[model samples]
Target: MAILITAKNLKKSYGKGKNTVHALGPIDFTVVEGSFTIILGKSGSGKSTLLNLLSGLDSPTDGTLVVAGESLNKLKSGKLAKYRAKIGLIFQFYNLLPNLSTLENVMISSWLKGISVSKQDATSLLKQFGLEHRINSNIKTLSGGEKQRVAICRSLINKPAILFCDEPTGALDTANGQIVKDILVKLNKEGMTIVMVTHNEEFIPMADKIITMKDGIIESMNTQISK
Candidate 1:
């Protein structure tokens, strides 16, 4: 498989001098196209920071980062926003607009791309995720698991080549979390590259590769047969 993301001597930090905090690399890494990879790390282990850097949401203080063939280090703010749309991001919080219905929330993401996503498609995706009845419901009225499902629908609105998820299953119960995991794995099988950050060990069984990070660097990486 071809490499979809590559980092060389990548470095990021917070504060300065005595208060400095190293959040990532001076390390090299590559993610193969269409692979489902899990990044495991505890709090303060730089998992979130690394995701931001990889997605071009933040600039690195030093070194080089390239994702999906774009040099993130070279993008200006406007360019970065466009770059981000190509790689969908799902967060622990659904981040839906409270006033918008579930279907509307999903459509809004595609609207940002200036494309009018069909209601039929949005409804189909949500229905497949077991949220057909919630299509016209207000986001604030939904349960935690339902909200997360809406977030997943929004993330896929653009049909991105890659998905970056930060604790996507964090707020859900075990059954719902597993449901989300299965959906992600199905998407990966259909050729969507997924890079997810999670502390949940249950996700390990679904991962094509497991990458563990400690402090500001990768501690270990293990690949397994895609089941």
Candidate 2:
């Protein structure tokens, strides 16, 4: 498989000098095209930081990050937005607008990107996640799982080459988490590359490879047997 995302000795820090804190890396990694890769770590283990760096939501303090052949270090803010449109990111929190309906929430980015998509197609994708009935419903009324599903829908609105998920199931109950996992699996089968950060042990069995991190470094990268 071709490499869709690559990192070379990637490093990040907070503050400077005496106040500086090394958050993650000086680590090297890659995500292959159409693969499902998981990064696992406990709280404060830099899982979210690494995801943010990879997704270009945060800049690295040192080293290099390349996604889908674009060098993040070389791109300016405007170009970064265009580059980011090809790489979808889903946060632990749904991050939906309170006044927007679920369908409208999913369509926001696409609208900004100037994609000519209809409400009909947006309705269809949300319905695929069993959210059709709630299409016109305000985001504030949805459950945690439902909100996350809307986030997933929003992430896919642009049909990105790679999807970066930060603790995707962190707020969901077990059943809903499993449902989200299944949705990810289905997306993977359809040839979408998925790189997820999670502490949930249940996700381990679903990963093609599990990479563990601790103390701002990668501890191990293990390939998993099929369940």
Candidate 3:
């Protein structure tokens, strides 16, 4: 497989001089295309910081990060915005507009990315996520799991090359989390690259690459064939 993400000596810090705090990196790794990679770490371990940098949401203070052939360190704001359009992001809290229906919520993402919105395509994605009956329902009316499924549909509407998720199932119950996890595994099997950061140990074996981080650095990295 081709490498889709490459980081060399990547680092991030905050404050200055004696007050400077190193948040992440001076680390390196590559994510192969279509691989499901998990970043495991505790709170304040810099896992989220690493995700932000890799997804082009934040630039590193030093070193290099290239995603999908774009050099993040060299891209300006406008270019970075364009680059981000090709990357999908999911958060612990379902980031949906409460007043928007499920279908509208998914449609809006494509519109924001300057892509034409197609209701048929949006409905198709919602159906694929088992949300066909809830397509026209308001976001607030959906259950936590249903809402999260909508968020995933929105993320995929742009057909991003890589999906970056930060604690995607942190708010759900075990059954619901499993529902989301199953979807992620299916997506990976179908060749969508995924990078997920979580404290949940249950997800480790599901990845093609597992990276464990602690105190701003990688503690261990293991590779396995996708199950």
Candidate 4:
């Protein structure tokens, strides 16, 4: 597979001098195209920090990060916004507007990215996720699983080159989490490049690569065939 993301001694720190908090690397890693990659660690392990850096949510204090041929660490605000549009983001908490219907929630993401998505396409995505019946329901009225499925549909509406997820299934119950996990696996199998961070070990075995972190550093990395 081709390299879709590459980091070289990537690092992030906050504050300055004596009060500084070194939150993440001085680390290096690569994500290959069409691979399911997981970054696993407990809270404060810097997994989220790594995800933020990877997704261009924050810039590195030092080192380099390149995704989809653009250097994230070096991009200006406008360029960074453009880079971000090429990716999709999902989080533990479904970040949908409670006032909006499921269909509206999905359509909004494309609008935010400067792309106009028709209602038909958005509905099709929701229908494919088994959420056809709830597409007209307000997010506040939907169950947790329904809310999350809407989030997934919203993320995909832009046709992002990479999907970046942070604890995607962490907020769901067992059955719902399984549904989310299965959907993710299905997406990866269908050629979505996914990079997810979570505290759950259950996701590791199913991924093409696993990066384990502890205390803001890599503890180990393993590669295996996708399950």
- Best prediction by lDDT: 3
Worst 10 residues of 1 by lDDT: 218-227
Better of 1 and 4 by TM-score: 4
Q: Model 3, 156-213: lDDT tens per residue?
A: 9998999999898999999999999999989988999999999887888788999999
On a 0 to 1 TM-score scale, where does candidate 2 land against the true structure?
0.95
Per residue, candidate 4 scores C-alpha lDDT tens digits across 84-148 of 87898998998888788899999988888889899999999999999999989879999888888
Per-residue alpha-carbon lDDT of model 1 for 1-227, expressed as tens digits?
99998889889988999999888987678899999889998898887888899877898888888898899977899999888878788898878889999999999998886778899999999998899999999889999889988999999988998999999999889988888888888899899999999988887987888889889788888887854
- What 10-residue stretch in candidate 2 is worst by lDDT? 218-227
Lowest-lDDT window of 10 residues in candidate 4?
74-83
List the candidate 2 regions with Cα displacement exceeding 4 Å.
Answer: 225-227
Off by over 4 Å in 1: none
lDDT of 2 by residue, 125-163 (tens): 999999988999989999999999999999898898999
Off by over 4 Å in 4: none
**Candidate 3 ranges beyond 4 A from true positions:** none
For lDDT, candidate 2 versus 3, the one ahead is 3
Clashing pairs in 4: 11-25
Per-candidate TM equals: 0.95, 0.95, 0.96, 0.97
